[model samples]
Target: MGIKIGIIGAGGMAAYHIAGFRQAGAEVVALCDPNEAVARSAAAAHGVSRVFGDAESMFAALPELNAVSVIVPNKYHAPLTLQALAAGKHVFCEKPPALNALEMAEMKGLAERNKRTLMFNFNNRARPESVAMMDYVKNGEAGRINSAQAKWVRRTGIPGFGGWFTNKVLSGGGALVDLLHMIDLSMYLMGYPEPAWVLARTFDDFITDRTFKGPWGIPDAVNGVNDVETAAHGFVSFKTGQALSFQISWAEMVQREEVSAAFQGTKAGGMLRRLYGADGVDATATDLCEFYTQDHGRSSNRVVTVESDPDMGRVRSARNFVRSIEGTESPLNTPDQALILMKIIDGAYASARSGEPVKL
Candidate 1:
């Protein structure tokens, strides 16, 4: 029999998980959300047998569930993950692991104590181009990665203009949490080095200005809160003497949206670009991966072609999670890695607030 899966949070992210689980051949047995109507609708749409208004009830009703995808808000990640582990269910949590480093660390410890597999849904790392890039770096084809620059900028984009996404207490932070995928993938490609310190700055330039809200119109801006930064820039230094510079923005006055990462090693360099538009969809363009090398004392660049499947990583991640539960394969995105990445994010925020470099 295949692994039995459950989906928490019947929102858009849950739908994303459902597609992947189905593609991976896992049976989604249950669906849960705080909103009863949402849960029922998702269950009907996804052909799930049961639905619950909350996670506790879902876990209680379905004891046979082997794994669950926790696709809730950032603040609930730690609590839900811990509860799922204690209940003997492996958890696959959505990205930005938790609201802070402390919560991530606690989740990691709890997962270890329960001997449960905890996986982060960092799907971007599973992309074909990303896999090839990782292989190149790990095989020493790029030598020791020393410097990297990654950016995910938008011309005018702020999700949920005044809702939980723009609220610091609910979503952790703005661009960092929402767009940290690029940063994490870049670091992963560089061997997951220990972050030494970070010098960072954040700005909330367009929160009060309605003109900056492009696609995500501000219907709730008046009553809702907007305390999070709209843009963030950080210079991260690793213990291995390597470094990365990143700038991510939710709303800014720029030419166009750019999602790209470039790494320079001691011997060679490489770059990857996702050709999605400012809305992050309508991919009329294909991804580009290029490597810079010196061949016979002459500088040369080679383009690496990767098969494009936007949802391939999510499907791969679902299959990998099931394999982990079966003890056939280890998880690719572990809670330990989440904790380290959270620390870097925390340090960046602290550094920005104190106006000084924060040490890890």
Candidate 2:
């Protein structure tokens, strides 16, 4: 039988999972959300037979569920994973895994103890462009990755002014966390190097200033505490002595969203020509999303480039996860790697807060 999958949230991403699972021939048995109407609506729309508000209740009722896609908020990642593991279900949780380092560690530990497959969805790492970049880096096509950069820049995204996103207690932090997709991808491409230390700085006033143009085009004057930083920058040193600089902003008054990773190797180098929805600050572009690379033999400083559709990443990631659940392959994003990502983020925040470099 195919892998029996369950989608645990009815938010915007739930539909993506539903469609991807169906395309992969995995059986999506249930849709769980607190809202009955939302649950039923998702189930009906996705052709799922089961819809339940309470997760524990649904798990008890549906013993055949083999896996679940936890697409809830960052705070709920831990509890939901723990609950799913206890229910004997494997998990594919969204990025950042959990709210903090402790919770993330505990959930990963629980999954291991239960012998359940716990995967974090770092879909950006699986992007076609990223795959091509990885090939170049691993094949010595890009020499030793020395100094690298991974950044995310956005015009404006002070989401739901007074909502959970602004509440650091709920979302952990703002753009630093909300827009960390590039951080994960950059780390992956760098062979998951161990960070010796990190220095981080954050800025939260951009949103409160109400001078930036909003992403969804909201009014100039929006109300919120802006407790979370709308921007964060960090520099990291790896055990290999290689370094990576990171930056992400949501409320900046930049021309456009620019999300990318640039890797500088000893013999060769490359970068994500375009990442996320970013069009490389080009307003009249459709964002082809290229992966460009340059080797030692090339002196022009211009790398060769390859481009493809960007929307295919989510589908590709979901298909991989479902296949892993069916025992046809191993988990795409292992818990070990996910844990490392969490630790790096945690260290960055610490360094940013104490104004001292944090040893990772």
Clashes of each: 0, 0
Identify the leading candidate in terms of lDDT: 1
Q: Candidate 1's residue-wise lDDT over 1-360, tens digit each?
A: 888888888876776677767766779999988888978987898788898888889888888888899988788988998889889988999888999999999888888988888999888887788888888887888998999998888767777667778888889998888889889888888888899999999999997666666575225555788898888999999999999999999887777777788999987899988655645567564478998899999998988887877674777776677777777776778777888899999999999999999999
> Between which residue pairs do clashes occur in model 1?
none
The local distance difference test score of model 2 is 0.76
User: Which parts of model 1 have CA positions greater than 4 angstroms off?
Assistant: 214-222, 278-286
Backbone clashes in model 2, listed as residue pairs: none
Give the whole-model CA lDDT for all candidates, comma-separated: 0.84, 0.76
Each prediction's RMSD over C-alphas, in Å, is 1.9, 3.1
- Residue 186's lDDT within candidate 2 is 80
Task: After superposing candidate 2 on the true structure, give the runs of residues whose Cα lies further than 4 Å from its correct spot.
Answer: 209-225, 275-283, 286-307
